[model samples]
Target: MRNAVLLPNGFVLTTDNSAGIGEKEADLVHVSDEVVAYFATRVALMEQWAAGAHPISIVLHNFSGNKNWDKYVEGIKKLFGEIAQPCPEITGSTESNMETLQSAIAVTLIGKQKTDSAEKYTWYVYGKPCVGQEVMTESDKIADLKKIWESIKSGLVESVWPVGSTGIAEECKRLGLRCELQGWDIVKSAGPATTVLLGIAKNRIEEAKLHFGKYFEEIN
Candidate 1:
């Protein structure tokens, strides 16, 4: 799979790339996957709700890549701007120098927000690194999730002991984190998902969004 992760921070600045964010990584390949997955998932989710007819607003954290990130920013802007009919209110990060993986993660996580809409459910998808993609393991995922929750939540974050593969969802419950299975089937069956957007796309982006569903809902 793509092995991308999207950890959303409810009310923080996108440019807050501070050391206190989370674990920092220097690997470029890993960083790129994470950043791309983050943006792609967000875009896909918004596009679904936009229904190809309404405008979706989003604040993008334009970080990651290397010093040459700008060369590719235009393509991203165009992809998000042109694909959806209404398009997203995409914006770049306020910070300039985001060279590390941690910085990118921190920037994006801090900027995430949740809104209550009686019309439709609002889901915040938190991406997780796939197995074998990163040197990290379920232990690492849990640790990272805990650190993030501690930094954000005022009360004690729920705790879910590792119970095997199926226990993945339970872990989220304990940590108070959201799970993104990358497919609508799992997402839809899992419960009411405002948006089934996830970053860990291995075979296909739309296929991943299916989340155990029989057929994948292709993203436009």
Candidate 2:
């Protein structure tokens, strides 16, 4: 299912990342607080935009102390800039009372959907599945958020599902697809949604293939 809650007014998309992946003393990955927040926010933003929702606000949950607050906000803004969209209003809290060893953060995006009508489309995968340290080292294989956003706006893509830790096969199952995705490690975790599942309009299949080039692969 989509990682969003449908409210009477709009959808609330939320995602979080934690563990020893930050710059904290206990973090095993040794990445900056900003990088950690960026990928975490990327998951939520992709979920919001994939559902054709316009983001209105953002809520951040910071557990890496007060000093990292501004860095987290900067990361959120950077993601929005990549999509050429203005950063939405952001408000959240930081865990200042206690010193946490690992870096942890969560992001919530409030967005409004533009249409209610549903359309049938073909499914495709964009980018390779990468998790953990691969997220940083094999970053080039990750899907381009900017390109995906533009394709959706241009009517080339009808819907999108960012593959998470559940992997590609499970996500397809969640979508109710019966076919197997050949030539891919369908069970590998796509940490922070390094890969994206695109629902393309039948007529725009070729166009999307051309637009995404080698990153696009048909799900058979």
lDDT of predicted model 1? 0.31
What's the distance in Å from true for residue 180, model 2?
3.0
Q: Write candidate 2's Cα lDDT for 1-220 as tens digits.
A: 3877777766656556666778788777888777888898899878876677868989998888899899989988998899998999999899999999788888888888777337778999998999888988998999998899899888888888899999989888888886466678989999998999988999888889899987678887
* lDDT of the candidates, in the order given: 0.31, 0.84
In model 2, the runs with Cα more than 4 Å from the true position are: none
TM-score of each: 0.30, 0.94
Best by lDDT: 2
